[model samples]
Target: MSHTATPPPAMPPKLAEIVDEFASAPRDVVLEMLLEYSDAVPPLPETMTDRAGMEQVPECQTAFFLRVEVAADRTVTTWFDCPPEAPTTRAFAGILAEGLTGAGADQVLAVPDDLYQRMGLAQAISPLRVRGGTAILARLKRQVREQIG
Candidate 1:
């Protein structure tokens, strides 16, 4: 018998592009791209300097906090706090921040929960790190739902 793998659900355009890139990239290139994204993680705005309002994702091996804001128009913006030492976690945050920010709440919520799996990150990074990324997506989506309600 022969079987075919099912494609992942459609994602937001930017995120889908990122996933497609990683899915086809060599392992070394994946790591390099992740590092590039790590550097791309945006700085927290002045109002979020305290980070008291952010939620922590204990699933991450490092200390990581994130906040998701949905504008009155239902556009989403994400902020993340992770030590520079934790490049992988920072890369995950950067991916979400860049891909999901400016997306509609419905679009953000429609994102598949197994986003990291689709990116093929486990082939380049540890499963634990991939798990952390998954948790980050979950938290971001939860916040989006809360904001919309």
Candidate 2:
């Protein structure tokens, strides 16, 4: 019998590109790209600086918090808080924040839950770390759903 591998679900364009990029990159390049993304995670907005309203992702080894807002037009904006010492977790936040922000809620909702797996991060980072990234995406998506409702 012959079987075909299932394709990943459709994702926001920017996120899809990031996943494709990491999927093809070498292990060293993946780690390098992750560090670059770590620097790309924008600082929380002035309103969110206190992080009082943010939800924590307990799966992360480091302290990580996030919030998602969906505009009337359904554009999604994400905020992530992660320590500079945890580059891997911050990179995951950067990827989601940069890629999902400005995207439509439907597009953001369409993103696969196992996005880190598609990004091939398990090859470059520890499985535990990868799980944190997965949890981040899950929480981000849940917040988006809550906002849109």
Q: Return the clash pairs for model 1, or none.
A: none
Cα lDDT over the full model 1: 0.87
Residues 1-149, candidate 1: write the lDDT tens digits: 88898764345789888888988987778899988899878988898888969999999999999998899898888889999999999999888878875688888887888888888888888999999999999999999898888
TM-scores of the candidates are 0.90, 0.91
Q: Give each model's whole-structure lDDT.
A: 0.87, 0.87
> Listing every candidate in turn, what is its Cα RMSD in Å to the true structure after a full C-alpha superposition?
5.8, 5.0
In the predicted model 2, the residue pairs found to clash are: none
lDDT of candidate 2 over 43-124, digit per residue (tens): 9889888997899999999999998888899888888899999988999988887787679888888998888888888888
Q: Which stretches of candidate 1 lie over 4 Å from their true place?
A: 1-10
For residue 47, model 2's alpha carbon misses the true position, in angstroms, by 1.6
Clash number for every model? 0, 0
Q: Which run of 10 residues does model 1 get worst, by summed lDDT?
A: 6-15
